[model samples]
Target chain A: MFATLACVAAMYLTPLVWMISTSLKPEAQATDGSLRLLPVPASSVVERARANYYGEEAAGGAWKPGVWTDPSVDFPRFMRNTLVVCALSVTGMVISSAVVAYGFSRVRWRGRGLVFGVMLATMMIPFAVLMGPLYVIFGRLGLIGTLAPLWLPAWFGGAFNIFLLRQFYMQVPRELDEAARMDGCGHWGTFWRVIVPMSRPALAVVALYHFMFVWNDFLAPMVFLTHRDDFTLALGLQMYQSKAGNTPWNLLMAASTLVVAPVLLLFVLAQRQLVSGLSAGSVKE
Target chain B: MTREGRENLAGWVWVSPWVIGFGVFMLLPMAMSLYYSFTEYPMLEGPVWVGAENYARMLGDGTFWKTLWNTAWYGAVVIPLATALSLVIAGMLTSKVRAGGLFQAAVFIPTLVPLVASAMIWMWLFNGRHGLVNRALGLVGVDGPVWLERAGWAACALVIIALWGVGQQVMIYCAALREVPESLYEAADLDGMGPVRRFVSVTLPMISPVILFNVITLTIGTLQVFALPLALFQNSKGGPGQVGYFYTMYMFDKAFADGEMGYASALAWVQLVLVLGLTWLMFKVSGRVVHTRG
Candidate 1:
């Protein structure tokens, strides 16, 4: 059992480990005939630093080492672009989904159930169906080349996120809404004072998931953001691979590692919440 | 306003963003796409209605058939394999291992890596000459095929990549595995069932509904796969010999690259029907196997 578990772990972790290992290798060592996981030891400490850590131009201007100094891959700029998009989309998704879910869960009305049911059915409509029409719409609006189309739809509330939030909102006590209402609170007041305060965990779950989704989103960005300056990290990573081709394996891996690090960091920090949030949202619902 | 009137108005007010959004983004686009499907719209000019021509053209489009086959082959293989792998991993974790949490985390971390980034990593790993995968294979004395360059190996490569992201499915199974009643296992044991027998008779049935749910959802997801292949292939040209070319990739190429908006819209509708049909089929076929709680 232990051996089996170790093998599984090795399988899962190898690509990631190789990514980091390849990122540290010099260009020759990266694409060389050798298959060492680490850089060979240099004769001197300065040479080792130059070969493995610091960027250096080897003899005859053949190779440049290190990811950051490679200059072709702009990690920080893409990171900024990704962060901005994620911030807008995640905030919009949480607030809008929570509001929409409030309507579906907390409010009572004649058409509420019917509308919410239709909304749930919308979850089944794949994004593939939306791709062509949305492109046309965005093109018509002159937002095709901008990041607006990529993040703006998030403000409308997606069916899946709304469903997740509504399920959680339903579990909140009805007495809270009534008590807030009895205190001369209107629907907005009751929602802000009662529901929002009580649903922090659910809200966090929605926010985290949305954050990851927007951060990891490749297709929308691929379709909408045409210019290199506006490329999100995921898209930028692809652009890097294509522009560089198979030559710069080390830098390619480095770029991939940089793009993957934040999400991995978030997972490491909040694996429990992430796991429970996703499982509860899907399986329990 | 009357009490009911006030409640109804407030409800609409609260959901107005989604309602407005649903109309503009979902309903309007769907209508436009349906309209576009029957017409010729190339983005350079207005749509000209041609009435089923786009759909008919799809029949003879060889690339369309190839992409459909590729997508179906991917779904057929990846869905079941991923499901079983997730379930087995979940089973292993639940079997009282030390540091099970760490092991689970190790497995789950890859799922968090964006599909685009995973493609990059795997592209490097699947490299013919210097990739770690081939290196590892060499250590085991088995020669690794040039994965991305060959049609058969490319499909296998994508499946392997897809399997890596089964962490989400694994978590769902783990949660479901925990919900399986211990008494069922005890009863099976009392009836002379060993570990294998107990797992087969008790655990599998108990978790069957979750399995069904995961399978359906996975089916929906895998059928629409795009980003990974988009990242993996050179020039985003789909995999070697178009073996990794999926349905969405084709739709994307038609709409954006080929500028055949009408045909692309028609393809989108076909994909929608196919996905809905397959999901429905799963519900029907798996109905007999899925055990619901009383």
Candidate 2:
């Protein structure tokens, strides 16, 4: 059992540790092939980029074909772009999803089930179908170049998140809504004061799901985001993938490692909740 | 009447955002796609009505047929393997193993790696020469085929990569597995039923609802998978001489690369309708199997 646990732990931890190690390695030593898992005199960060050896002939100037290594680290900017898109998308998803879920869960309108069914049905619609139209709409809206393409959809009661929250809301007793109404609490007031307060675990699940999803999403930003400044980490890394020359894979891995860590940590924290929520069909409603 | 009106209004207000979103994001696009399916709509030019040309063109186009076949094959093969593997793994992990929680986490973590990242990992892992797969094969005195470059093997490659994230499905099965009552297991044990018989009679029926959900969802999800195949063949032009190319990839290429916006839009709509229809069919067919508790 201990051995099995160790193996599993090792499997999960290895790639992560490789990412961290590669990120910290001075580019020269990183690429030098002599330095395997451990860093070669790897204590410092800045000096690692421009070493005297390993074909770097100049100090951050034009490089010759065989040997010029322009060692520059854009890790910080990479971090920023990733954070902005992920933050916006996750936030938008949570608020809008909760609102829609609130409507589906508690409200009693005609065509409610039909509308809900339609929304649920859309979940199966492969994004392939939406790709053409979404691009065209965003282009028309002139929202293509910005992060609006990323989060605006969420502003429209994202069905997945809404569904998730609805399932959770259904699990909660109708008595809560009744009691809140008895206290003269309006729907918004009830949602904010009573339901939302009680739904912290599920909300965390939603937030974490969105955070991980948007953070990891490769296709959306690849299509919509045009500017280098607008690059989310995933898209930015895709750009990095297409980067010419030796393709500093270790550094790319580093950026990817960094990009996935916070999200992974969040997942690790909420993994159990996510599993239970999924099984319980909390969002399936 | 007044109370009913108020409740209806409230419901509408609550679900209003979804309606708005669905209209703008989904409905509008669908309408335009239907309109454009008849027209020659490229991103560069305004769409012009061309009648059934696009659909007709799809019929004659070998690549389209190939893409459809590849996607169909993927759905047929991978769905079963992924489902069966996940069910088995979920059962194994959740069924009173020592350190089950750790195994559960181990299984699920791969899905969280993001499809893009997983593809990148597999590129190296599936590389012909220095890849871990080939290395492992060499150690065992066998030569490994280049996974992504070979046609017959490339579809297999994507399927294998897709298998990595079977963890999510596994997680689902695990959750559903817990829902199976212990009494059934106890009764089976009392009757001296073996693991195979016990699982067949008890576990399968108990988790049938989830099974239905997983199959339908998995089909839709797998049908639309773009990143793995896209990423796997990033430098190679397309998937294993387009042998591994699936429907989404075909639509993506048409829309983004080929600039056949109307055609792509039509294709997209077709894919959506197909998925919806299949899901509805599965729901209908599985009615006999699924136990809906009142």
Candidate 3:
């Protein structure tokens, strides 16, 4: 059992380890016909300035490779664009979903159940069906070739997040709503005074989930954002792969590592919370 | 106004944003797409009503049929393998092992890496001559096929990548596996069931509902797989001979590359029906097998 588990663990982690390993290898060694995880130490420490890339070489410098200098793929711009989209989309999703969830869980209303059901039903409607019409709609709004189409719809409540938040909200005692109302709080007032403070963990889950979603989303950004300047990391990586030059496996791996690092770091730090929250989304009571 | 009336009004106010957005985004587009499916609405031009022509054209469209077959074939192969793999892995994780949480995290970390990045990583790993996969196979003294270049191997490569991201399902299954009562396992032991029989009789039935749910959802997800294949087969749209051409990929190509919006809308509608219909079918079929606690 121990041996089998170890084998599985190695299988799972190999691609990731290879990704990091390949990223650190120089162009020559990266493409060299071997599956070595670590770069071999060069025999000589002398600076081979003339033969080296960029015409500048210190001791052992030629062995080290950096993805930053890739002339074709602008990693910084991709990172910035992706960060902007993530920031806007995550904030929008958290706020909108929470607000809408308040309506579903905190209040008793005539059509609330029916409308909420509609929202949940729409969750089953795949985004593929909406792609064409949405493209047309965004094009009509003159939002094509911009980041607006990527992040704007998030301001509208996503059905899944709204459902998640509503489930969280329902657990908050109804008496809190009543007490807040007794203290001259309206719906907004009660939500601000009572629910938001207590629902911090739930809100964090929603935010983190949406953050990862926006960070990782490809098809939407691919369909909507056209220009090189607006390319998110996912699309930028695709563009990098599709570029006409000889594939720089090292730089490509570096680009991939850069794309994956932030989320992987967050997951490592918050594995407990993320695993619970993610499984909670799927596993029923 | 009565308190109930006031509450109703407030509810509307609070949910107004979602309501409006749902209308504009979901309802409006769905209605418009249904119309577009039956029309000649290219992006640059207005719709011209062409009753059932776009849907009818799918009958003769070889690519449409091929893509649908590829998608169905991919889903049929992937869903079961992935589910079983996750179930087994989750079962292993549930054993009284040291550092189970760390192992779980290791297994799941791949899922957090964006699909595009994962695809790129796999593309390199599936490279014909120098990929780690082929090299490992070579070490075993078996010749490795040019995975990305050949039709069958290209599909196999895609499925392998899909299986790697089964971490999410594994996590769900792990949670479910943990929830199965220890009492049940003890009871199975009392009945003198062997390990395999114990698993089949006790553990399997206990988590059958989760299995069913995962299968249905996996089916839905498999049908809509786009990004990984797109990124993996960047030059080919789909890989050699469009072997990786999936339903959504076809829809994307038709709508964007080919500028055949009306036909793509038809494809989209079919995809929606296929997903919903298959989900419904799974529920109906699995009703006999899925054990729901009364």
DockQ of 1: 0.74
lDDT of 3: 0.85
**Weakest ten-residue segment in model 3 chain B by summed lDDT:** B230-239
lDDT of 1 by residue, A139-236 (tens): 88999888889789999998888998888888889998889988999888988998899989888888889899888888788778888888888877
User: Which pairs clash in the backbone of model 3?
Assistant: none
Report how far residue B72 has shifted in candidate 3, in Å: 0.2
The sequence of per-residue lDDT tens digits that candidate 3 reaches over residues A48-165 is: 2122222234387763324554556677889899999889888899999989999998888998879988887787789989989999999989999989988889999799999888
| DockQ of model 2, rounded to 2 decimals | 0.48
TM-score of chain A by itself in each prediction: 0.88, 0.79, 0.89
lDDT of 1 by residue, B26-114 (tens): 99999999999999998798999999999999899999999899888999999889988998999998888988888898899898889
Provide TM-scores for the models.
Answer: 0.95, 0.89, 0.94
lDDT of model 3 at position B117 = 95
| lDDT scores of the candidates, listed in order | 0.85, 0.74, 0.85
State in Å the error of residue A222, model 2: 2.3
lDDT of 2 at A246: 46
Which stretches of candidate 3 lie above 4 Å from their native place? A42-66
The single-chain TM-score for chain B of candidate 3 is 0.96
CAPRI classification of candidate 1: medium
Candidate 3 local lDDT, B225-244, one digit each (tens): 89988888884668898988
